[model samples]
Target: MERRDIEIFLTLAEELHFGRTAERLGVSGARVSQTIKRLERRFGVALFRRNSRHVALTPVGAALRDDVKAGYERIQQGIDRAMAAGRGFSGELRIGFSSPLVGEIIMAAAEKFRTRHPDCAVRIREIHLSDAFSALRAGELDLQITELPVREPDLSYGAPLLRDQRMLAVPSRHPIARRASVTVEDLTQSPVLVPADAPGYLLDTLVPAQAPSGRPIARVPTLTSRQELLTLVSAGQGVAVVGSQAVRFHARADITYVPIEDLPPIEYGPVWPGGAQSSRMRSFITLVRGLRQNEDDVTRSHDHEPSD
Candidate 1:
């Protein structure tokens, strides 16, 4: 069936009136009727039961309408992919970052990418970790930089751009900064600032709960962004937990990163839809993967030597 035929069906399904559908589509009512007739003939199914006063979808038509909507979405995506290829990085790339730390890396990469492909436009949005998967699935985001591996079946991800341990960000003079490593219990009674986009998997699954006294007191939920959390921690408002990458990004004298031995390692990577792939996406992934490798090598080199 022709695309216009499906469009006509969808418009009629929504309007439930031939005259309204024709007016909305900027076509004559007779043309609307003809399009619906053509669609029914092509599909060999009665799509709508129409009387002088009412128009309604049959059971078969209802099922077909649902499938047609999905089909139209797929067609639109295909057209988008084709247009993106034809323009060679001329369209806007909508990217989502899970936190400000990841945003920094993505912004840096975007700058470099734009220099090479100056025609391309980049728009970045800070999304909560909880909403990242949903946004991507809904086609609201083209790419996402988040902690991986993401659990959604409809999502796929490139290899990690950076992998680092979680650290406790405390005032430089905090007693915990003197330790080689810390446990969850070490944070008891310490006011902790948490980012709103902070992944629950990291906090709930990795960090242990309760002290030896069996009292849970390891969480504080006052801050929402990395900047806010770090600002508060720097001001001695409270301590906060962050990835090791935060140490590289911010080197304020008031805040220090303390290694946390018990927490799981965090992986930061690019995420995209499972079935969608494009040359631009592949190139972006390559750039991030190279950055991660370079960072890893530099980290390993530093681990073998003492600080000056």
Candidate 2:
């Protein structure tokens, strides 16, 4: 099938509604209908089972989708790489990371990117929570992999690259530290230490203002860095909620990391200054997304395996 045809079919397969597919593709509903009908005739099979109410892929259609999606992505990546080379993708790409876990992931992606485009130099730096967007806005960083819910008007972000369970970090001597896991309602019992300079939306994920039961969750917004936050928590100033990665990467004798059973997983993604994106930025995003997709696929496959 042609690229446009593949796009239409894939979109329809995803949406399962002709009207919504047309809306997504910015085409008329009749045009979408005609294209599917034409493809059905060419293939001599009904790709979709559609009537007045619902639509779904036929068995063959499902197989085709599974096979074509990866190839389509690879083809698009090829085009992007070619365009990037033609545009001289040799300039330095300055990237930032907010946390140690994200920093490690960025380093891995940078290695792959350098191997693929040796001429392009990749520079990595840490983006402190106290000054989240200053480096990006000032052109000091081309991109950053940080926590999600980036709502600034001048910034754009990609799909989440990493997601981990939220964990609470408290002093080792704290009463709740001995528990297997803690719930959101338990947050009311301790004051949460939070970043002093981050946006309220982001702070909410790390240290919510209230528990699920409407009880106020006291907070101490006095930290500028992860180490300082942990130090405060270790000193028994207050507890902190952080990504589960902290348990593995930031373990300390004075602090304890316990999973928050009731909180959502924290997400990290690429954020950049809003407007036209550079070829280098786009290439990096594509690489990270591809890596994340592969990891997710592997995890899903393992999840479905039959155990002895």
Candidate 3:
């Protein structure tokens, strides 16, 4: 019926307890009950089944929950767009980024964007790759920077802004550190330290068919962040597979980054919600596209230079 009613319904549907939902919404239990009653009266249908112990969504309420949530999200997006329009292209751009390279590119582009549109504001949030898609879908993020070829039908992904090859990071003293390049089979005997955010491409393409079995020696799922993974590798706890950008960021004395010739190269790109393009978003995309072309030209020129 009303926005507040929808919010209350969603909250109650999730918590299924009046007191808990009220606590979460920072309202009184009586107010929450009153709101539900008003909603039911307006709809002429009961939305919840209540007992002394708990509350559960009725069949009609269960069906309505998703539709209401979608409607609320669309309404919120419209409000944000209206507010942004009132301020001109001078409004904030909330970007979601996953990989480190994406962050660097966005920072570089933000500087350029700001110089041209000084009144425009930029905010970047580093999120899990999986969460990036969901955040974009929910209208929380204006743009996303991630690996290319995003499969979601609701989103459209652009071409690569930059490409970085995967590298094997090992302790300098490790036996394979002296090699010019390594392969997945070469890592079979070593305990691999995987970053929780290791891109899907690496997982599908680089992991060995069978690691040398022995209690998995050391599986460090505890390392959630890239910094933590690098730290563990530097400590010689285990070897890690990471992007060249990561190696550039943390060139620790203990770890040596070697090119892995056998693995697939990684490419980072920009993604946005399908059918939600804006003038500001188009401007940012154009900037990134120009940057990518410049990078390609530089690479090509270097490739043509004579070898010593």
Candidate 4:
């Protein structure tokens, strides 16, 4: 079968909705229907059972999907690999980072990338709190390891490389600091401190403007850097929420990190421009995804281990 036909079949099988499959592949619903009908005629079997409300893969379709998915991925990888080898894949990859923890992780992946594809040069730069997406848009960096809620329509982000449980950062002398753990509502006591230039959506993601209990979280002064925020917290200016990475990289004698009972884990991932998926970006993303997958596999293995 043709490559595009295979892609159309695989995508339709996964979505199971003609409209959605069409939207995803940038084709019309009628086009999707026609392609599927053609494939069925060629294969001499019904691949999908469909009606006015829903679509479903027949047994043959399921078997075909299972068989075709892996082989399709391998083919794409082979093409990318050959493209890389042909181009000598020796270009500079600029990486942007926000936190030291993300910096450590992305840079580690960069080191591994260097060892494997020694032709490529990796450049790491610290991106400011307000410049996260701006740098990527400007093409100053090829990819960036930043926090989630990267909802810009022009940018694309990969699966998270790391997820850190959130904690509240407060002065060592604060009342909340003395507690073993605090709920998200406790932000009323100190308010959410964030960079003034941080987009409202990002601010909401980190520490919502209002707690689940409907109490508004007071806003404090502008912040430029994490250290500055920590300084303010240390001086009892206000409490700020941070990821667990702070416990390792930003621990200070004057500040304490207390687990937030209800906040979701902070997700960190690699993001790049939507249309600029280069050889370097794809390869680095693959490496980062592999690392996350291996970690997940080990965690699952441990979870399933038989206990004595």
Question: lDDT (0-100) at residue 302 of candidate 4?
Answer: 100
What is candidate 4's lDDT per residue for 1-308, written digit by digit as tens? Answer: 89988888987886678886786566888999999999999999999999999899899998998799789869867886788888787878999988887787677789878986788899999986665678888879889988886888999876566778999998998888789999978988676688777777877888888888899899774788887898888988888888888999988999999999998988887788887578788788767655665676589689999999
Query: In candidate 2, what are the lDDT values of residues 47-73, reduced to their tens digit?
Result: 999999999999989899899998998
lDDT of 3: 0.73
Alpha carbon lDDT of residue 49, candidate 1?
Answer: 98
Lowest lDDT 10-residue stretch of candidate 3: 212-221
Task: Order the numbered candidates by TM-score, best leading.
Answer: 2, 4, 3, 1
Kindly report which residue stretches of model 3 are placed more than 4 angstroms away from their true locations once superposed. Answer: 1-88, 130-138, 152-154, 197-202, 205-220, 302-308
Model 1 / residue 47 / CA error / Å: 64
| TM, every model | 0.57, 0.79, 0.60, 0.72
User: Tens digits of per-residue lDDT for model 3 on 47-145?
Assistant: 999989968889989889967876775775566556556757777788887777778778877887776566788888887643447788788898988
lDDT of 3 at 42: 87
Candidates 2 and 4 compared: the better one by lDDT is: 2
RMSD of each: 17.8, 5.0, 17.1, 6.3
| Candidate 2 stretches greater than 4 Å from native | 1-65, 306-308
The candidate, 1 or 4, that scores higher on TM-score is 4
Quote the lDDT for 45 in model 3.
Answer: 99
